[model samples]
Target chain A: MLPKKVKKRASLLTIFLLLSVIGVFLILNALNKNILYFNSPTDIKISQDINYNKKMRVGGMVKKNTLNINDQEIRFIITDFKNEVEVSFKGTIPNLFAEGKGVVAEGKLQDKKFFIAERILAKHDENYMPPELKNIMKENAE
Target chain B: MLNYFYNSNIFTWIEKLTNFINSIFFALLIAGLSFALVFSPPDYLQGDSVRIMYVHVPAAWISLASFSCIALLSIFNFIFKIKHLTLITKSIAPIGLMFTCIAIVTGSIWGRPTWGTFWAWDARISSMLILALFYLAFIFIHKLVSDEDRANKISSIVAAFGLINIPIIKYSVEWWSTLHQPASIKITGSSSIHSSMLMPLLLMFFVLIMYCALIFLMKYKTEIIRIKKKNLKRL
Candidate 1:
């Protein structure tokens, strides 16, 4: 028969393991909505009830020749090739923000087709290529 | 190995080494801070406020390293049932918590000037906050549980459970689109930061590591003495 101390240790270990599993499950479940991913134009397009008030990120390539620069606002079109959404912002954009580059705009959706971005993130790759240019390079290499 | 360490003069040697390093750490800290604050050029984007990176980054690094040490010690203690391992883990917790607090506060101070806000629910900051909470839970478990062996068991379990957060914290900036900048130093490639700025940052990192070591050694010595006194009383 196991000693009393040994039995106590075993039971404690079992309880600890059980608690850890439950804790992980609960945390992941709760964080599912908060752990936001960059929604493609298609994802935003297909969704029925778009979140207009909550801040969300939409990521895609800045469409070439669609960028409009004025003294007041900078506007561009973000496309996932299948669908496109117009984005407008007014600020000093990141140095990497250029046409035909991948960008993630963080703000609320104005409607199904328009996004008013509070912050424009210029997404880049490891090799210093803008994400959109990197994809194009890959496609050309193939 | 445990018996050898207990019987030999290793702890005394560690004490002396840490004492020696303590003086060097102070000297380097003053010099590093001067160089970082006065000598280093202001960042183009952040201007003078970027100097806070010298303190915030190193403290964050040390806090993460300390937690990694606690997790590793907990694993060894659980596997081998070594009392010394548990004692060392217990000693490191408070110091680790202090470093985590420094990182957070300094980060917030830095954020106000740069990010225009003290706090955001960004992934990197949130994950770091979670890590600090785990450290708190570890310390609280040790205090609440009266039984020595049981306390060690539960605290070690907590430390091991908290190990999952370290990777999440490290990769949070890259994995999520956060306001926090991506890591300048990459393992496979050379650092992207200029060498002029990198020098003071590296020196400050060394100073913080030495500081943590000196504190850890002192705390571990105190724990050993307390355990010895308790054992004597029991006898």
Candidate 2:
């Protein structure tokens, strides 16, 4: 048999490792339940039984010329190119909210085609190419 | 040999190096702040409010880095039974806690203008709050325990366990839908942030890291001296 002191130390280390593993497992499982996945318009279209009442996120490019801004509400069409969903938000949209930009709207869906966005988040492109370089690329492509 | 290295010249050399770096860091801190606040270009989307990133991002980065260091040091202490490693861990805890606090507060201020709310139960923000709590618990365990050896072991266990939160915080934005933006600075690929804005942000990050190292070294040295004096008294 191992020495009593060595056995005790080994058991202590085992217990600590087991506790850490269990704690991390429980925390990640709990967080997974609460996480809201951002769905593209295509995901929303393909999934037939999406819960309409629960709040969800719909992210896609804002279709060009679909924006309708009135004093009371702002409306736009978010498209994944494969499918499109119309979003209407009453709140003041973010400054980056514009046609053809990427956007994520969070709220309940009135239907598959209609989304009442409680919050509108403008998502910018990750590219940070200089304007002069961008012009050069555009000319080369042309 | 180890005692000679510790006694003869290494400590003096470390002190000199620390002083030199500390002076350079102070100058860089002032210059970086001025450049970040006044000279850097306003964000294309966020405007002047983006200046907050200079402080908030670096604080967040440093706190994560500090916890990672603590976790690694805790492991080394466990394996090698090194007293100095635990001392370093003790010295780092309060500094990490302070940086976590700065990150949270500055993030709240930045969120108010950008996200239109001071706070939200978003994934990224909540994970950061958990990190702050871990730092608090680490310090609390150290304070509550009377025996130095017991305190060190317990706090090290806590620090090792809390290391799980670091990866969660880093990946929270990507894994879940959150108001907080995705990382602007990519590790392997090109950064999303413009070079004009990134330069000042990087400068501030360097200054803050140097500041953390200086404080950690000073605190570690003091702890070592205190321990030595206590041992002498017992003798």
Candidate 3:
């Protein structure tokens, strides 16, 4: 058996280890609580029953016929298989941004379905060349 | 009797002072985390999502700060042959690893809301990922070596090399078109965050620093005891 003094020291060390682990757990929990998260068009539809004031993200492909480009606001429809969301934004659209492409909109919920976007993120595939150009290159080789 | 002898250890004064300092830092950390929770303002753009900055920024900052501690300790160990410095570094590795993981996890969570994706190869994000890996590698190496002297030597060399990643992580956003935002609060820079947001962030940052300080000191104390026990066994 270890001496009483050694046992005391070991117990002290155990307390520190426990505190450190608790500290990390608390930090992670705090982080999860504070950060908002992205949802697909279908996911937003499911979450519509929950609190709407909470900040969130909606992601989908921008529908081809949905973009209404006016002077200041560029409104569009984002759609997943089962649902679609109308997203309105007044900012510089990303370079690769266009119809029939993946886009994620960040902002608030209004009318239970529409998302008022503060920032619109347009996602592009690794190839910078347009899909049409990529097809053309393939066609020429073939 | 036993209590008297234990309390009268050779470094008792140093231990007392370190404990005092550790307590102060621990208090500040708790205060900061709580303040950040209650008082931080909503973002004009991000709304509630802005609060993620409190945890995310501080995690990133302290991960870098721990590396700074490691680098400094590594240099001291190499130059002065200070066994205490190596002990401090070993004590700090796990804490650093935990913080780095927090920063990455929080950053990803925040990104999902802001950038529409959970993961990215953006320069800032990738460099931070590498940093997390470096910390893991350091811990792994520290564990692998059975010899105390050899472990210290190897880990110090690793620490020295890992210091290079710190600058890269800091400057990656500035150098590249990254989804990650630039520094909101720095020693130099006009902060764009409103006063309400700024206060909580500062408070949380202070708390994280204090947390790191407290853990480091506690670990160092444990290390000293461990070394003494080993010496006693030899005797």
Chain A TM-score values for every predicted structure, listed in order: 0.68, 0.69, 0.64
Report the Cα lDDT for residue B115, model 2.
58
Docking model 3 quality class: incorrect
Question: Per-prediction interface RMSD?
Answer: 7.6, 3.9, 15.5
Tens digit per residue, CA lDDT, model 2, B4-70? 4245465686699798997798689889989889988776556677889899999999999999999
What are the Cα lDDT values of the candidates?
A: 0.80, 0.82, 0.71
> Candidate 3, residues A27-81: lDDT per residue as tens digits?
5357542322346777667663646686666766899988999997999999876
lDDT of 3: 0.71
Model 1 over residues B28-118: C-alpha lDDT tens digits?
Answer: 8889889888987765444576678889989999899999999878866765577888778888999889999999999988766655457
Q: Across residues B1-235, which tens digit of lDDT does each residue of candidate 3 receive?
A: 4244235463675567677777687677667766666655455344465578789888888899888888777755654566666776888888999999999999888767655568865667877888888888878887899887887767776676677678778876555445566665556866655566677777888777666766776776788788789889999
- Residue-level error in angstroms, candidate 1, position B109: 2.2
Worst 10 residues of 3 chain B by lDDT: B1-10
The best candidate by TM-score is 2
| Error in Å for residue B57 of model 2 | 1.8
Better of 1 and 3 by DockQ: 1
Show where candidate 1 strays beyond 4 Å. Answer: A1-33, A37-48, A53-107, A116-142, B8-11
Of 1 and 2, the candidate ahead on lDDT is 2
Better of 2 and 3 by lDDT: 2
What TM-score describes the B chain of model 3? Answer: 0.87
